[model samples]
Target: MLKQAGANAWFHKGDLRRAQAWYAEALAGMRAHPEFGMEMWKVYKDLGDVFRRKGDNRRAEEMYEAAIQSAYDYYKPFKNRELAKLNCQLGTYALESGDLDRALAFFQEAMIQVFPEFNNADPAANPAPAEVYTESWIMDACAGKGRTLHARYLRTGGEADLTNAARCFDLAIEGVRQLKQSLGNDAAKIYLGDFSHAFFEEAIAVNFLLWEKRKDPVFIEKIFELMEGSKSSTLQNALQLNRAVIFAGVDKDLLRREEFLRVSMAEYQKRVQEERMKGETKDTSQILVYRKKIGDLEREYDQLLQKIGEEDPRFKSAMREVAPVALSDFRHQILGKTDRVLEFFMGKNNLYILSFDRQHADVRALPLASGVYNELFEWLARFQKPEAMNADYADFLQTGHLLFKQLFGDLAFPSDRPLKLLVIPDGIAAILPFEALNLTPPGAPPVFLIERAELRMAYSASVLTQQENWPVKTKEWVHFAPEFRTGVRGLSPLLYSARETEGVYGMTTFSGRSATLPAFLEWAPRCAWIHLSTHARSGGNGVAPHVEFYDSTLYLPGIYALRLSAEMVILSTCESGLGTIEKGEGVMSLARGFSYAGAKSLISSLWEVNEFSTAGIFSGFYQYLKKGKTRAEALRLAKLDYLHSPDRPAFEKTPWYWAGFMLIGVDGPVRHQSPVRAGFYGLCLVLAGVAWVIWRRRRSAGHSSLRRA
Candidate 1:
């Protein structure tokens, strides 16, 4: 304790060298007396901190590694909060070195350690003690993560980075609010500290970046909202509403909830059937009364659920509904055509939109006829395939010109300033690469849509409006390469997958294994980045696709059962992204299941992939990701690399190899392991080597005796 005090005094005085010396002495003293019953992990950590401050990063890392290794060797589990703080320091060191990718990775690792639920696990089942996840620690990690992403966005100009950063800030604020609500005003004050203000400043800065990019007043209003600090209360209310909505659907009486909803639905259906059967004889007043009664019962049922939610603590974070943000109230954010927001909706028969600015909403039918739009997209998907590219290019171009004219004719965007299009596509249009569409006039050279404007996608405008900041974890890769049986129908040898996995694994700390059924089930949840190079066939509605392995098959349903917790999952196989497209649920592909299971991003092929080209392109993608590129940018660069690699023929340069895969989720780089940890593992290898020599000698002696006999 005296040594610790001396180190602290030196650190506070800015005498980093003295602090390091004192910490080293403390560690040595503690190590010398094993019967003292005191742990030296804190001393090691302090030494690491002092070394880091003194600009000796190598020693700092070694000390940090020693802290973890020593604790493990002594059979003492480091408290979760301690682990988080240590990782945060490591991330800070990485940030100082300009290794933004490595920094984000460490920050994410800290976050997951703090909030295990973020890893897609039920916290109750593997609960951390209350002291293990302090409100302050969570806030710091979130703020740190936000700052890292904001820095990355500045460097890369990737909108996703800023958007994700915004989310981190929201989560920090949310954490504070949850603490305050759970512990009451007086008790929660202890946890609040300066985090609220820090979060506010960081949030304002991120919103400023977003506002500058889109020139939207909404972001500006958000900045003001932060200053006022009323948003937290509003968010808490939304949380309550969310709980009400979720609980309403659940039957309180065991199986009764489903039965009750089912009975109500059945009655409504029966009423409709009776009206149809009676035709003119049906009483319109009675039918209206019956509908009113049903509506009243539903309202009452929902109200009861809300009341129950108010009484329960567990349902606090459960979503009740999209925290209500009125579209009319949000109109002030839109200024004019230069900063307009258009949300497109594709129906079975026609297309429509809610195109608006602060002043007015141009809610009307799109001029593009249904038949033409459908036919164009169908051809577009077909044209993107390698085998049909030569024959389909002319068809694609013809349809592309018509699509360009019809889609953009009404929305007159300015040519001088950059147009930031927040696209919300539906139906087949969701997967369509709008940027690649040919926009050149009839009987003119090709000019793609991407050249005209910058595009960002959102599921709904509400997603942006109700966005709350959350912490993200470090990235790690988990790849699966399954061996296939010969003569299996549609099964072909994908030897190049091995090359792709090998190159990607070399770039980062990898958790790769054979695509056996057991291996996939075990590793899928723990890994942050996953790549599966195997045969896949997407199933129809209610039927999920299966990923084949030499030992067994992993069906889509099986994926849902596992906790994913991954940042990205790459399905490097045929038609891996295709699934039954539902109106409200989006596409239900293997990618979708992984997304549901907790994967934040996915790289899936729209069609079959060329094995050799895929290997090279995938390797290039990992290289780009390592350089701090967003998933979309990395994938784009990979395609460009493939295009320029061998100066391939025009037909080969077509969309087949490049455009087949699409990124769907938050684009964050994978986690990187520290060299210190690697060194520790190297020591383990040395011990193994010694054991192997002993075994070899014993075997030689046994062989000599056998020869004598």
Candidate 2:
């Protein structure tokens, strides 16, 4: 194990020579022991990777073949899956080497290994078999086959080949959807989502190529469906399941048991993390125990969900494969006449953008600029270090304008009205600060994208449409602003959070020591609006992102277990909107955590935020909310106010201060019935009741007089 670990460490550091040496040693040692035979395949695979990195294609193929043989000989139970994966790796290698025939054969063999039924099918007749298989490895095989066919089509200009490639992609995506639905927990589903993101991108690209070649609207529609199907699918599934459980009338006891299991799993996960943080002295046995407990709880929870589904057919149907909203339905139901959606899917060769309004939809592909992904990371880093931007304002402006043009230059916006644009970003574009993009030329006075449009973001058009009527349990707001004056848990004091709390009104406030995790759990679900003004850490080193309370921190899993009905959640902390990017799943941030816990909308920071600036911006944000502005408009107005504030220093007015804070999810008004309005309604009801009583008495008296006559 140590040898293998050493090899892995060197491999990640790009020390191919050192990694190869360690892997060779590990392979020799494993070969010596029959007990370690099952693990030999991994050492073989590692050696293959090392050789591949060194560009020793012959040696790499030999190592890969040896790994497959070792898995077949020693790993009997899961040998099929292992074989499929190995075959797919070889297929990729063949494709990269431009051996189209060899690549296609390897990929088909991979698919057959997983689903033996495919062994008899003719590869040329139908690349995607009708038989459904749930294993994720099949997705990889289908993707490999599709890519191979696509390459062949490009070379030979064969229409049949292109059509077969599209079919292969269809099977790949269906496999993804099936695997996601099969998962019992969100964490597993989210992790799985990262693996298949490239498949979706490739699928979309292939479909787009078909659309261009054949001029068929069906191909265009397929691209949109693929985009919507892959984006934020876990979140969409969670939303659907919640709705199904509620509407299916699952028993309260069963629901309670499910929640209990989830909480238990989260607690054990946290315990494992805590134990692992003990470093070299950590108790391995205890960590193992915690893991076992978590696994057991997950299994139990899955069974509970299954039982619920069995009891209510509605739940079972709802939990079936998720279908993305059609493009026409999305435009009609989700987009206003003035609204447009700019959905992006970044492929290996091109960045495809789908622009749609209420009445029109268009798709365009642009060859990706070299190092554009690196440029995005650099831009985000600059936001974290504002002084860098201040030093080269002109360069910053020019670069930002260039990026804006690259991303949005071809789209035509309506001239008569301001646009309400919803941007659905994929891949590295997830963390992009769209509002900061300068729309004007470098020499011209900066006109940011935010100035031309009221901007909001969503995971997908389907998610946006579903959130339109998400239930809000209460009209009340709750605020938690903990002052970490003692540096508990190594956190600095939030000097302005207290001030921020003071400036806000009509909220159930928990400040200082009173703002604990328990308090948050108690009140967060009951309130429609929640504001947590404290410190937070972005996820790293295997730890999930967490928000610090006075007594404890709530990690992502803990947040997921919560059942919140908040219309909006405000995370007034650093990098609350940033986390380890999980390709198709977007950022695994605290913002997403809250979204999983049922928050319809969120206001979170993209970078380390200035406490004072955050306080001022949110004060105005709530004020705008009080005035019945949409959440997007309110946030926009607040940022604009902060940017134009005369009292703020000129340096503070840069995009760094205001642009990092963004609103994601449903951007609608916070509906609160004021005390004055409530009193007026009560008075009107009372007056109407009195008039009814009087009319009833008069009618009775008139009837008595008539009888006497």
Q: Rate the local accuracy (lDDT) of all candidates.
A: 0.60, 0.81
lDDT tens digits by residue: candidate 2, 1-709: 7899999999999999899999989888887877888788888888988888888988988898888788888755443777788789888888998999989988887887787556643568443455766887888888899999999999999988888898988888888878877777777887777778888888887888888888777886888898887788888877777666555567889888977887898898788777777778999999888888888888888889889888878778877765578987777776752378889887766778888776566688877656566566766667877898898888788888878887786666568855788888887787788999888786898988777778888878777776766766577778898888888778888877866545344567898889999988888877888888999888788677988999997888888787777778899998888888776777888988888778888888888888888888888887776677788888888888998889988899889888888878887665566322343456778899999999999999999999999
Worst 10 residues of 1 by lDDT: 120-129
Compare the candidates by TM-score and give the number of the best one.
Answer: 2
User: Candidate 2: misplaced stretches above 4 Å?
Assistant: 1-94, 105-123, 127-129, 245-248, 277-281, 313-318, 366-369, 412-417, 485-490, 498-505, 672-709
Quote model 1's TM-score: 0.47
What are the per-model numbers of colliding residue pairs?
Answer: 16, 0
The C-alpha RMSD of each candidate to the native structure, in angstroms, is 29.5, 7.3
Instruction: Write candidate 1's Cα lDDT for 555-631 as tens digits.
Output: 66456445445656788887777776554334556766565455556677777778878888888877776576656
Q: TM-score of each candidate?
A: 0.47, 0.82
